[model samples]
Target chain A: MKAKIHVYLKPGVLDPQGAAVAGALHNMGYDEVASVRQGKLIELDLTGDDVEAARVRVDEMCAKLLSNPVIESYSIELE
Target chain B: MKAKIHVYLKPGVLDPQGAAVAGALHNMGYDEVASVRQGKLIELDLTGDDVEAARVRVDEMCAKLLSNPVIESYSIELE
Candidate 1:
């Protein structure tokens, strides 16, 4: 099974790295681009009974390791 | 309108940051975690008539700026 997980800073959280990237983009001349927030995408290949199991394991992984529960949130999509 | 963009390093591209995160996970006791790849997720609140045009601009932004086209790929999901 394969999956993609997206982890992001919660709304209202400060993301300096994201701000830096946005500044770079504007400097590169993409003026319409207003703000940027950077997050993480994790793709994994797993051996599982099916997508459900993969989803379960992935959810656990995200909760336990992939994200910081204090200030980040994550969602997963299976493919 | 709102959307999420995920940018990832192409397969076979080395991602030392991802490696570092994976190592952190392992140190924090996730032995099932073997390897990790880090990517970027950007969320935007936009002014647009529909998702399609937003998609176009977003794709262009990703291609020209958000990601390095030479060694990366990206996808977007709207909600």
Candidate 2:
């Protein structure tokens, strides 16, 4: 199975990297840009017989490894 | 108009950041994880009269500001 995972910082977490990228955009004449947030996309191939069980495992991965529980969240999709 | 933008490192780029995160995942018992790539999701509100024209402008923004053309790529969707 092929899946795409997204990990993002939760709202209220200070994202200095995102802020810096947004600032760069504005400075580069992208005045139409209102805001910029940075996240992660993990695309992977899984050798799994059951997608439901695999999803559970992937979620566990998110909780235990893929994201920082204190500041980040994640979502996954079977593609 | 509301739009969501995604910026990602181009294939073959050295993604040390992604490698670091993937290594962390493996260490945390996420053996199912095959790979990890980091990217950006930028959501914004645009004050535009024409969406078609706005899309072109946004593409320019991606090229000139939102992404580093040498190693990154971007996509945008009007929401």
Candidate 3:
């Protein structure tokens, strides 16, 4: 089984990297770009096939180590 | 309109960050996790509502700056 975790900065958190990207885009003549936000996608391949159990475990993984609860939020997808 | 780009390392490229995260997960008792790959998600808010044009521009962004074409690949999503 595989678990995909999408971790993103929470709304209202300042993202300097995203800002930098936006600025670079503008400089490159992409003036149509209004805003940018950057996040992370983590794909984990696991040993077990049990979807429910995998979700439970991966959720714990996200909470404990994959994301910073203070400023980032994460979603999980199982396959 | 909005565009989302998902950029990932090419399959043969080594990802140290992913390896570190996998090791951390193992240390945190997630022994079932076999492999991990980390990627980036970039969301762009654009001025035009034309999805096709937005896609074209964002794809150029990915090619020119957002991703390293030699070792990474990117997928674009318009919204």
Candidate 4:
């Protein structure tokens, strides 16, 4: 089984890295770019076959280690 | 318009960050975890409404700035 996780900052949180990207894009003549938000994508290979079980476990992992719950949220996709 | 970009290291590249993550999961009792790869997810807001032009521009951005062509591959989704 494979699990893909996207961990992103919450809406109210400020993202300096994202701001830098946006600024750089604007400098490069991509004036259409209004905003940018950066996040993490983690792809994991697991031994399990049950999608439900994998989803539950991966969600727990996100809460415990993969993401900072105070400022970030994560979504999990299992296949 | 909104664009979502996923940038990841090409397969066969040594990802120390991912290896550390996998090791951490193992230490946390996630024995089912076989391997892990870490990447970037970037979301951008644009002023334009043309999906085709946005896609082309975003693809160029990935090639020129968002990702390293030598070691990374990127995919773009426009909405």
Candidate 5:
């Protein structure tokens, strides 16, 4: 099984890296870019076969180590 | 318009960050985790409403700034 996780800052959180990217885009003349927010994508190769069990375990992984719950939220997709 | 881009290392490219993450997971006793790869997710808020033109411009952004074409590949989603 494979798990694809997207971890992103929660609403109301400030993202300095994202702000830098937006500023760069503006300097590069991509004026259409209004804002940018950066996040993380983590792909995991796992040994399990059961989708349900994998989903549960992966969710646990996100809460335990993959994300900072106070500031970031994560979503997981398993295949 | 909103654009979501995922940028990742190309296959066969060495990823030290990913290796470190896998090592951490193993140390934390996630034995089912076989391997892990880390990537970037960038969300952009744009001023334009035309999806087609936004796609083209975003692709250009990826080629020129968002990703390193030699060792990284990117996928874009518009909403």
Candidate 6:
């Protein structure tokens, strides 16, 4: 099984990298671009065939090490 | 309108970050985790309401700046 975790900065948090990207887009003539937010996607391949177990384990992974619970939020998709 | 771009390393490419994360997961007791791949997600808020135009512009952004075409692939979604 495989699990994918998407991590994003919580709403209301400042994202300097996103802001920089927006600025670059504007300078590149993409004035239509008003704002930007950047995030991360982590894909994990697991040995287990149990979908439920993989999801639970990945959820634990996210909470323990994959994300900063205070500033970021994560969602998981299992396949 | 908003556009999302998902940039990922092409298959067969080495991803040191992913490897490091996998190793960390293993050390943390997620031995079931066999492999990991990390990617990026970029969200753009735009002024125009034209979804099609936003998609096209973001596609160009990904191709020219957001992703390295040689070793990365990008997908864009607009809403």
Write down the worst ten-residue block by lDDT for model 4 chain B: B48-57
For all candidates, the clash counts are 0, 0, 0, 0, 0, 0
TM-score of chain A, cand. 3: 0.98
Provide the TM-score for each candidate, comma-separated: 0.72, 0.81, 0.98, 0.98, 0.96, 0.96
Compute the lDDT of residue A12 as modeled in candidate 2: 93
Compose the digit string of candidate 4's lDDT tens values, residues A2-73.
999999999989999999999999999999999999999999999969888888899889999999999999
TM-score-superior candidate, 1 or 6: 6
Higher-DockQ candidate of 5 and 6: 6
For model 3, what TM-score is found for chain B? Answer: 0.96
What TM-score results for chain B when candidate 1 is compared with the true chain B? 0.85
Off by over 4 Å in 4: none
Candidate 6, what DockQ? 0.91
Better of 2 and 5 by TM-score: 5
Docking class of 6: high
Model 1, B1-79: lDDT tens digits are 6668887888899998878877876677655555777777787655555778778877877888777989998888866
Question: Is 1 or 3 the stronger prediction by DockQ?
Answer: 3
lDDT per residue for candidate 3 within A8-63, as digits (tens), equals: 99999999999999999999999999999999999999997889988889999999
Question: DockQ, per-model, please?
Answer: 0.44, 0.59, 0.95, 0.93, 0.90, 0.91
Tell me the lDDT of model 5 at A57.
Answer: 84
lDDT of 4 by residue, B1-79 (tens): 9999999999999999999999999999999999999999999999979999889999989999999999999999888
Q: What is the per-residue lDDT of model 2 for residues A1-79, given as tens digits with 9 covering 90 to 100?
A: 8768888889999988778877877787777767667777776667766899888888887787767999998899986
**Model 6 TM-score on chain A:** 0.97
Q: What TM-score does structure 2 among the candidates reach?
A: 0.81
Q: Ranking under lDDT, best-scoring first?
A: 4, 5, 3, 6, 2, 1
Task: Write down the lDDT of every candidate, Cα atoms only.
Answer: 0.77, 0.79, 0.94, 0.95, 0.95, 0.92
Which digits, one per residue and each the tens of the lDDT, describe model 6 over residues A39-64?
99999988968888777788899999
